[model samples]
Target: MTDAILRMRGITKTFPGVNALADVDLTVRRGEIHAICGENGAGKSTLMKVLSGVYPHGSYEGEIHFGGEPCRFTGIHDSERHGIVIIHQELALCPQLSIAENIFLGNERAGRGGGADASGRARHGRGRGGLGRLLPGLRLVDWNRTNHEAARLLERVGLPENPVTPIADLGVGKQQLVEIAKALSKRVRLLILDEPTAALNDEDSAHLLDLVRGLRDEGITSLIISHKLNEVLAIADSVSILRDGRMIETLDPSAGTVTEDRIIAGMVGRDLEHRFPPHEPRIGEEVLRIEDWTVHSPARHDRAVVSGAALRLRRGEIVGLAGLMGAGRTELAMSVFGRSYGTGISGRLYKDGKPIEARSVREAIRHGIAYATEDRKRYGLNLIEDVKRNVSAAGLDRLARRGWVNGHEEYRVAEEYRTGLNVKAPSVLSETGKLSGGNQQKVVLAKWIFTDPDVLILDEPTRGIDVGAKYEIYSIINRLADEGKAILLISSELPELLGMCDRIYTMAAGRITAEVPRAEATQERLMSHMTKEQEQVG
Candidate 1:
């Protein structure tokens, strides 16, 4: 029997009016990959936070045992001292900093005069240290030595050796690897990864999973929290299900009894016949059309993100744009929605076969177009604002009279959608940022739906949301289509696209490579188009 590396008993966490976790118990064995599965807001993150000391000792009721010793970690630093590290779903690395600097940020070296410097030689890099004395140790950084260590750590996490590169320069997958490297920098006995591959492409996700298995071989234990069932089955040796912040069961993966359905059943307390509802096509006339659309990347010159892309969305149809990361599906949607993403965009759009000019977001909305961005926190919704403000933001002009905002009108508008969309929030005045990711996404959706758009472009609409929330969003999409709204769905999950869309268009290198109808689309065909393979010469 493998030795248990970490154990939590009767872990109960409570917030103002909600029980985040209740009697949750999890046992992670040494050198094994243990996966935690649950729906969104099921308390997966809260449970991890408890274990990693994010909630601290007295803040929550729990008993944590790490490596056979009871622990009461006051903060993240305290947990790190005991070789416990967690890489959250949202990476904690500074995008502006170099890979090396991000890895050694709080643990940086200082000059002889106690000034911050990265030129020092290497010394005690293990565990966390106070920021005050960090600067005085600059002489110990040793760029060459730090780079060598960083390179080795990156290799361990299946990343390329480029420590000097800025964190922003790397792709999401690479940045995730850097997060893992940072965690591994400390003498991590147990590593906790929350949605590590959520943003990664298939190739990158596969590589990260492989690295997890590699880490297990190296005698390092891991706790993986992910929504990707196939990925959990691929890498996990043991699987634990959490529901409503409580542990349901822990099953051995090698027993051959554990299946995706079983995991879902354990998670939701009922059998889910299908992960997605069956789709029936009710095709209609084209409501939106794009001709010879092209967009240059804002960050890169001489690069076209969307190159002569042409597509059509008919009323009562959901057209899915499927592609690998960097394929420009989001860019194309953003540029079409009012040139919100790129520069030098040239696209001729037609509404009901009549040319329509949309130079900005307002113009796009005025022309009955609404776009829900993938990155809800950064682009879709203002986190600091309340649900009422966020939901009524895009359509504030409708609620305004003579340049004086009508508070009651806005509240009524927000209340209508809040109830209509089944948004779970304390009140309309609740801050959008305080809501769970699923709720936040719903607010963004509510905002767009309020626009009464003829054509709605949903970019990764269900990304990072829970399965329950996904079902709601899916149902909303179907209803919108049934109501004769033209919907353009861009998603990374092929299954989602296949399940919800009437037709799926696969993109490769900023161009539509294949258009597969719901009747014909398959994972095999879609993946073929998504992979970056050179086009054959005639």
Candidate 2:
């Protein structure tokens, strides 16, 4: 008997102007955590899509063998029937559905029984619309059995949420567990996670990795696609590297050869001597300062999202706001940037020691202030629009002539930033959505940078991009600071802040708890200050 549970030979996949995968060969031994590592657009996700039948059988040239049996999966359902399930990073859960309903969704089990919900109508698996919209072969869900099975699966994944809990109520980490629980409900044999923990905080990431380990121990094989090389090094039994749509090499960490450095060398074809570019800040007079800034929640009228937040940014200085999730970092930044978020806002803003008021986004831009949102997909860029439109969106007035936008000037400005930022796209006409995460991030930066802002507030500037892309973004930030632009950087990654910021401020319970200089900062100290309110209350 052979130990291999999965084997794909000569997998060649192509898109309209792109060869996603080229004669790639991948093998997986039974009960092992195999990681796939690559930079953005290296075809890692495309390869997984092929294996999981997102590209279908006739769409790609490949031979797949699972459990020594030749497989021809035509769609996601076909792969699922054979115990292969993939969970994408964005998550497919419907926020309004209950845990049990989402777990049993699509893979619905029918019964010859009445399943009337609270309104006395036939419960249709908590799907939108009505009961008539159930999946084609599935009718009449047995709610009792569904809830029981969901509870059992939840226990297996170590999620203690009630089966009836709405998916929106749980955090991203718990939502991930529910996804795995759904996979287990299908009796999954080979599980694939595509950038599973990219959105999760550190504690949640640790829990998810531990759960993957536990699942591996139970004889389940896992394939993880991640940009986080450190996490891959910690959990992967074997790692496969992909570059330029070709298989480079697979390394076994058990033999002590697979390291972050080794993996980076393979992914980018160079030794990344430094993850962050060194910088010497040219500190100058205070560019912007906020005194007694407080913002109440819009939904909850009485709740103070940002309470008495006081911070200052100096010319050519990068200041970091470090906090745990919901600690008011984003809220503070948004409210200060012309009340983009929060309500009942009270603040005093000064620029270059002169008082200024920006009551709207337009006014903020007029005052030479720009806010780059963390959720780039949602608020930053119009994904359907091309690069030129997004780049000139914030500062359209500059290209406007007699109430009409000069397309020629807009294109010129966008092309300049595109070349300067090294945005890897065909041209300024490519749709923003089609580009990779790193390039999309550059577009977001280009949008704000076009405004020619003197103060830039970048929230989670490098959240989901690869390390190489992150280095590029860091260099951009350094260049901005060198140009005498005061930056307020907000990030959850402590190492990133410690490396890039000249000073870091800790916030907890919506209040600025401590301001620590980079020379005196450590992760432990930052964490302690971040949880100060919780510690005091407990």
Candidate 3:
């Protein structure tokens, strides 16, 4: 028998009108970190889903050998039985549940059975249907044992949270650790992490990476699906490049110094000379300005989410908002747009030197302003709907004749953007849920663009997109700026803001600490301002 712990041969999966995976092969040694890299629509997630039995045995053509045994897993539970567990990009944790409960939600520990059942089980351990004596109905949860085991698993993943604490209280980074703990609960041998650190900050990402390395030392085989190439080159012992639903090639980074440029070439099938499209900014007159903006949290009306913030946007200019995850960048944008968030909002909005009120989302759109949400799937687009509906979501009135909508016009408008934005979908009729993260972002851009807004507020526009798709988005932003739209770009990545914005503002503790021109902004300088201590002001 070979030393490999897992081998997938001739894996092919197809969707309606889409061949998601075709003849893909992957081999993982007993203990190694293997990374899968590709563009957004590539078969990275699809391949992992096949292995974890999300596609199941009969749905795809593949032969999977695990731990020297030919395996046929019919469901996620079956794969878990074989020690395969996959943590998806969007985490599957219930916010209301405690860490321990979430970890063992499906797989629970039970107390001793009833006297009758116990006696029967003692007589015949395998009961009537050959199912175990511990029936779910008679299974009372052993909370003390559950919490104790959960703590052990949490320690293994380096999470220091109380197992009984609600998952909602933890940050995204900590929540990820809880997910790993949940995987360890299953005694997982083959762990698959999809975009593990996509939502993490630099510190948290480093911590997560270190934890993964620790897991490898413990003899666990990990397969990571990520668009971040630098991460792939850093940790992956073997790197597999997938493109257009076919296996291109696999390389060993440990053999030599494998550059990010090389990985990009394999992913996009071309030398991506520039991360951002070249642009010369043409900043015109001020189009939108905010004065003394303050917003209180809707839940707790006394707590201020944004305070005394002032900002300005000029036509043909792209201004970047630089802040950490909870630095009120989004709060400020949403409040200023239409007071969409928070209570007790006190703000002065100006358009072309005239004071204006945009107290609602509809009024904001009517005022020629648009805001693309940070969480696109949650607040931006209707995922179940088709491309045409999502594309023309914000500007339905443009396609509407009085009270009725013109479906043909909506399709025409969506098609125009689909071609212009280069969105990779089967057609305008295709469900938005089926589109990749990058393409879905384009559709969100199309929705806002269709509104013909003079001011565009983009929140983390390229959050989970690959480098190639990021370049395309940058080009789109530049084009929009060139078309004389005042753009406010909000991003967590300092480099993205530096590369794309003409002017950048750093926020700390619900306040704008500093404004740096493009000529002066650097990661270090931005970080200094972003980390500045805020005054205890309301």
lDDT for each candidate structure: 0.85, 0.90, 0.88
lDDT tens per residue, model 3, 318-366: 9999887678999999998788988899979999889999999999999
Candidate 3 displacement at residue 463 in angstroms: 1.4
The estimated TM-scores of all candidates read 0.93, 0.94, 0.91
Prediction 2 global C-alpha lDDT? 0.90
Highest-TM-score candidate: 2
lDDT of 1 at 373: 90
Tell me the spans in candidate 2 whose CA falls farther than 4 Å from its real position.
Answer: 115-139, 534-538
Task: State the displacement of the C-alpha of residue 501, model 3, in Å, after optimal TM-score superposition.
Answer: 1.1
* Off by more than 4 A, model 3: 113-137, 534-538
Model 3 scores a C-alpha lDDT of 0.88
lDDT per residue for candidate 2 within 400-476, as digits (tens), equals 98999998999999999999999988899999999999999999999999999999999999988988899999999
Tell me how far the alpha carbon of residue 245 in candidate 1 is from the true structure, in angstroms, after superposition: 2.0
Tens digits of per-residue lDDT for model 1, 1-538: 2889888998999998899899888888989999999988888989988888889999988799999999999999999989989998889989887888888778653323322223343444322443335644334444555666777888778777578788878888888889889888887888999998888888899888888888889898999998888889989999999888788899898999888888989988998788886556577898998988989988886899888888888999999999998888998998998888898888689999999999999999999999999899998899999999999889888888998879998999899889988889989999899887778888998999988999999998888876777888888888888889999999999889888888888788888777788889999988987775344111
Per lDDT, what order, best first?
Answer: 2, 3, 1
Winner on lDDT between 2 and 3 is: 2
